[model samples]
Target chain A: MKQFLHSGFVRLAIVVVMAYVIVSLCGLREHVSILSGVDESGTMHLVFGLIYILSYAASLVLAPALFLAAIIETTLSKVNVLSRKGQEGRRLGCSELRERQRLRAPEHAP
Target chain B: MKSRLCISAIALILAIAIWLPLLHLFFRPDIGDLGLEKGVSRIADQLAAHHLQIWTNPDLRNRELAQMRQLNPEWDFMSRTFLVMALASIALRDESRIPQCLETIDLVIENTLLIEQEDGFQDFLLGYGYADNWKVQPPKSIFVDGEISLMIGARRMVADRADYQHLMAERIGNMVAQMTLSPVLSAESYPDECWVFCNTIALAAIRLGDVLDHSNHSEFLREWVETAKLHLVEPQSGLLISAYAVDGTPLPNGPGPEGTSIWMACHMLQVVDGAFAQDQYQRAKAQLGRSLLGFGYSREWPRAFAGVMDIDSGPIVPFVEASASASGLALLGAAGFSDKKYLRQLMTSLNIAGFPTRKNGTLCYQASNPVGDAVLLYALVQGPLWEKAK
Candidate 1:
C-alpha cells in the first residue's frame, strides 16, 4: 500500500485535488472576473485571479489525467506481478518434473 | 523498475489521449434545445434570474457596478442597456413574465437617467472622454444617447409607454442632428472619434423608434449606409473600420476590422440594412472568426491590422489572438445571422472557458462580469426583439 501511495501518478492526483479544494475554499473564484477586465481591486486581486485560473485548469484537466494515470499504473503493476508469479510457478513445476524423471530413470536402469 | 517506468509513462500518454478529446463534452451545452427559434433558453433564464436578483438587491447591484466602474464606466452603462434589452426580449417571448421584466426595466431606466442627469453623460464615459472638447457644443455622447434610446425603444416595443416614447424621440432627433453634421453621417462616441459599433447601434435604435412611433427614418438610414460604404470601410479587409474621425479619416491608431466592433455592428445593422449587415457578417466571419479543435473564437483584428489590446478587446489570447469581448459579441452575431454551426462552436468555447456558476436558480460566469453576463443573455434571447423590429 505504501509503495502504491508512493507512485508519481498518485502523488500528482493528490496535489491537483488538494490545490483545487484549497483554492475553492479560499473564495478566489470571484476574482476570475479579472479576465473580463473588471475587478481591478489591486495587484493581489490579479494574483488571486491567476491562481484561481491555474487551479481551475488543473482541476479540470490535470486531476482527471492523474486519476486515470494512477488507475492505469496500479492495474499494470498488478498484471505484471500476476504474470511474474505465473512464470515462476511454471518453472518450479518443470524442475520438479525433471527431478521425478531422474529418479524414475535410475530405478529403470537397474 | 525501468520497465515499470516505461509502462507508467505509456499509461499516462494513453490516458491523455483518451481524455483530451472528451473533455469538451462535459462542458458542451445542449444547443439544439436552447430554443433559439422560440421561447427562452435555459441559459437565458438562468442568466436573467441572476441579473434580476442583482437589480432587486441594491447591495449586490451596487457592488457589481462599483467593480465594473473601477475598470470601465462604460461597462456599467452597457450592462444596463443589455440587461434591459434582454429583459424586453424575455417579456415578448413569455408574456407571464412581462410584469416582472418591465418592473426591473423601469427601475434600471430610471436609475440610469437619474445618474446621467446628476453627473452628466460623462458619468458613463472613460476618463479620456473628458480630455478633448466634443466638436459639437453642449457635448453629448452618442454612446450614451444611442444605447439609452435602444433600451427605451425595446421597452416600448413590448408595450407602449408614453414617457419612453417622448424620451426616444428626443434621443433619436439629437442623434440625427449630430450625425448629419459629420460628412460621414456618423456621430462620435468620444470627441472626434466615431466607432462603427456605436453608430450601428444608433441606427438600430432609430429603426426601432421608427417602428414603434410611426416615424420615418428610412432615407436617413439609407444615406448612412451609403456613406459608410464610401468612407467608413477599411480597404484592406472590405469590412467597416472600428474607429475614424468625424470627417471620415481613419484614426491613425484606430483598429481596422476588429471583431469586437464588427460582430456587434453586424448584429445591429440587421434591422438597419439586412443585405449590408449580411455582407459584413460574412466578411467578419471569414476575416476574424476561427475554429480550432471544436472551439470557436474571434480575433480582435484581422491579420493585416495587428491591433493592440484595448479595453474593448479585453485580453487577447496569445497566438490565437482571441478577444474576450469579440468572442462574447460573436455569439450575438452568430445568433443574429442564424449560423447554427458557428453558434454551436462558439457556445462550446464559451462553456469550456466561461466558468459558469449556478446558485439558487441563478447562473453567472465566474470569469465574466455584469456586462459580460448581460451580453451573453442578450445573445441567447435576441431573436424575438429583432424579429419584432423587422
Candidate 2:
C-alpha cells in the first residue's frame, strides 16, 4: 500500500479529484467576471479567479502531469521487474547446466 | 533522481498539452438545442417563461424593478416597455399563451402609463436630462414619449385596446407636431438632446400608428430617413451617431456604434426602412460583434472609436474588449437578423457567464439587472411584433 501510494500515477489522480471538489465547492464558475479579471462588485475578483485558474491548471496541467508520471513510472518499474526476472532465470539455467555437465562427466570418466 | 525529475518534467508538459485544448469542451453547451426550430429556440422559451412569471408575480417584478430603479429610475420605465413588447411577441407566436401574456402586458402598460401620469414625464428623466434646463419650456422628453408610444403600439398589435389607442394617438400627434417644427427634424429625449434610439422608436410608433389608425406617415418617415442618411452618419463607420443636438450636430462620442443603442435601434428601424435597417444590422454586427473560445460577446464601440466606460457600456474587459452592456443587446441584433451562429454563441456565453438563477420554475440572471433581463426577454420574443407591424 505504501509502495502503491508512492507511485506518481496514484498521487496525480488524487490531486485531480481534490481539485474538482474544491472548484465545485467554491462556486467558482458563477463568478464569470473572473474570466475577464473582474469581480461582480466591479473590482478584481482575484481570489476566485486564482482558485478557478488553479483548478483548471490542476485538471489540465498538474493532473495530466501526474498521470503521465505515473504511467512512465509504472512502465519503468514493470520493465525493471521483468528484466530482473529474466536475468535470474538465465543465471539459474546456467547453474543447472553446469551441475548436469559435472554429473555427466563423472559417469563418462568412471 | 535526475531520471525521476526528467520523467516528471515530461509528464508536466504532456498534461499541459492534453488539458489546454480540451478546456473549452468543459464549457461547451448543447448548441443544437438552442437552434431556431419550431417557432422559437429553447433558450428563448426558457427566457420567456421566466419573464411570464415575473409579469404575473407582483412581488418578483417589484423586487427586480427596485434594484434597477436604485441604479437609474429610467430603467424602471424601460423595463416595462421591453416586457410589454416581449409579451406581445410571445402572444403572437404562441396563441394558447396569449390570454396570460396579454394579462401581463396590459398590467405592465396600464401601470407604466399610470406612473407617467402620476409622476409626470420628468419622473422618467435621468439626472443629465434634469440638469439645469436642457429641456424645452414644456419639458417633454422624446425618450419617454417614444418608448411609451411604441409600448402602446405593441400592445394594440397583440389586441387593440381603445384606451391605449387614444393615448397612443395623442402622443403621436404631439411627436409629429414637434418633429415637423424642429429644423433638424429630430426630437429630444432629454433637454435639447436627441437620441437615434429614441427617434427610431418614435418613428416606429408612428408607422404602427398609421397601420392601426389607417393614417399616412410614409412621406414623413421617408423624409426623416433621408435626413439621417445625409447627416446623422459617422463619416468613418457609416453608422448613425448614437446621440445628437437639436440642430443635427453629433454628440462628443461621434458616430460610434454603441452596443446599447445599435441593436435596439436596428429593431425599431425595421418598421421604418427594412433595407436601411438591415444595412445598420450588418454594420453593427461587423463593428461590435466578437467571439472568443466559441463564446460570443459585443463591444461598446468599434475598434476605430475610442471611448470611456459609462453606465451603458458597463465595464469594458481589456484585451478582448467585451462589454456587458453590448453583449446583452447583441442578443437583440442577433435574433433580429436571425444570425443563428452568432445567436447560438451569445446564448452559450449567457449560460456560461450570465449567472442564471432558477427557482420555483422562474429564472433570472444574477449578473444582470432587470433592464438587462428585459432586453434579453425582448430579444427572445421580439420577432412576431416586428413581423406584424411590417
Compared with the true structure, all predictions reach lDDT values of 0.89, 0.77
Interface RMSD of each: 1.8, 5.3
Off by over 4 Å in 1: A1-7, A42-45, A69-110, B1-10, B32-35
CAPRI quality band, candidate 1: acceptable
lDDT of 2 by residue, A1-110 (tens): 45546886777678786887788687775554344321234444667656665675566546655665666656665676788799999999999999999889978994
lDDT of 1 by residue, B1-390 (tens): 798998799889987877777787776678753448688988889999999999999999999899899889999999999999999999998999999999999999999999999998998999978866687877789999999999999999889999889999999999999999999998889988888889999999999999998999999999999989998898988999989888988885564888888999999999999999999999999999998777889888998888878788888899898988899999889988988888888888888898888999999998888998999898888888899898
* TM-score of each candidate's B chain against the true B chain: 0.96, 0.92
lDDT, model 1, position B230: 91
Q: Which 10-residue window of candidate 2 chain B scores lowest in summed lDDT? A: B32-41
What fraction of the reference structure's interface contacts does model 2 contain?
Answer: 0.26
lDDT (Cα, tens digit) per residue for candidate 1, span A1-110: 66567879878888988998999999988888777666667899999989999998988888888778877888888898899899999999999999999989978995
Q: Give model 2's docking category.
A: incorrect
What TM-score does structure 2 among the candidates reach? 0.80
Candidate 2 positional error at B52, Å: 3.2
